[model samples]
Target: MDHYSFDQLPHAVSELHQKLDSIQDLLLESRQPVPQTIELMTISQAAEFLNLSVQTLYGKVCHREIPVSKKGKRLYFYKSELEEWIKSGKKKTMSELREQLPSLVVGRKGRRH
Candidate 1:
C-alpha cells in the first residue's frame, strides 16, 4: 500500500499537472505545420542579398551562371543555393599555390628533376 501524507498531496498533484501541460503543449506543436527554413527570395531580393544590380543578376540568370528557379513568368532564388554558387568559384591565390608546390613536388612517382 502507498502512504501519502497531506503535505505530499499538493506537491504530487502540482507535478502531475505540470507534466500533463508539457505533454499537451508538445501535442499541439506537433499538429501545427512547420515553416521552411530555407526561404526563397524574389529576383530583386536576391540581387540585394548578393549586392548586385538587378540587371546584372538577370544577365547571370540568362547565361546560366547563377542558380535560379522559374515558376511561370517569374524567377526565384534560394539564399542557401546562392551562397553555394558563390563558394563554387573560390580559388586559391598564386602565393598560396606556390607555398603548396614543394609538398606536392615531394613523394613524386617519377625521378626528381
Candidate 2:
C-alpha cells in the first residue's frame, strides 16, 4: 500500500476534528435545558386554561375587561389572578339565586293591581 503524505494526514485530521466539533456542538445544543421561566401563554392557551372560548377571551382583552400585561405584541396574564377571578365568579346554586332574587322582586302587595 502507498503511504499517505504527513501534510495530507494533518489536513485530514483537522477536517475530522472540525466535523467532530460541529457534531458535539449540535449534541450540546440538543441537550440544553429548556428555560423554566414562565412561558407567556398564547391567547388559545389562556382561553383553555380559563375554560372559555377564544372569542370571550379576545373580547375581554379588547375591552380591557380583564387584568393583563402587555409586552410588545404579546399579552400576559398572572395565572394566580386568573384562578382567583374564576373562583370568585363560581356560579351560585339555584337556591342561592332564589335567596338573592326575593329581595329584588316586588311582592304582590307592592305591585299595582
- Name the best candidate (by TM-score): 1
Residue 103 shift from truth in candidate 1, angstroms:
8.3
lDDT of 1 by residue, 1-113 (tens): 56779989998889889999999999999999988698899999999999999999999999999999999999999999999999989998999999998887885756657
Candidate 2 per-residue lDDT, tens place, 1-113, comes to: 44669878888889889999999999999999987665467777888898989899989999977767888998788776677777887899999999988776856558786
Evaluate candidate 1 by giving its C-alpha RMSD to the native, one decimal. Answer: 6.7
Q: Which residue pairs show collisions in model 1?
A: none
Every model's TM-score: 0.55, 0.42
Q: What is the lDDT of candidate 1?
A: 0.94
Alpha-carbon lDDT, every model? 0.94, 0.82
lDDT of 1 at 70: 100
The residue ranges of model 1 lying beyond 4 angstroms of the native Cα positions read 1-36, 93-113
Each model's backbone clash number: 0, 0
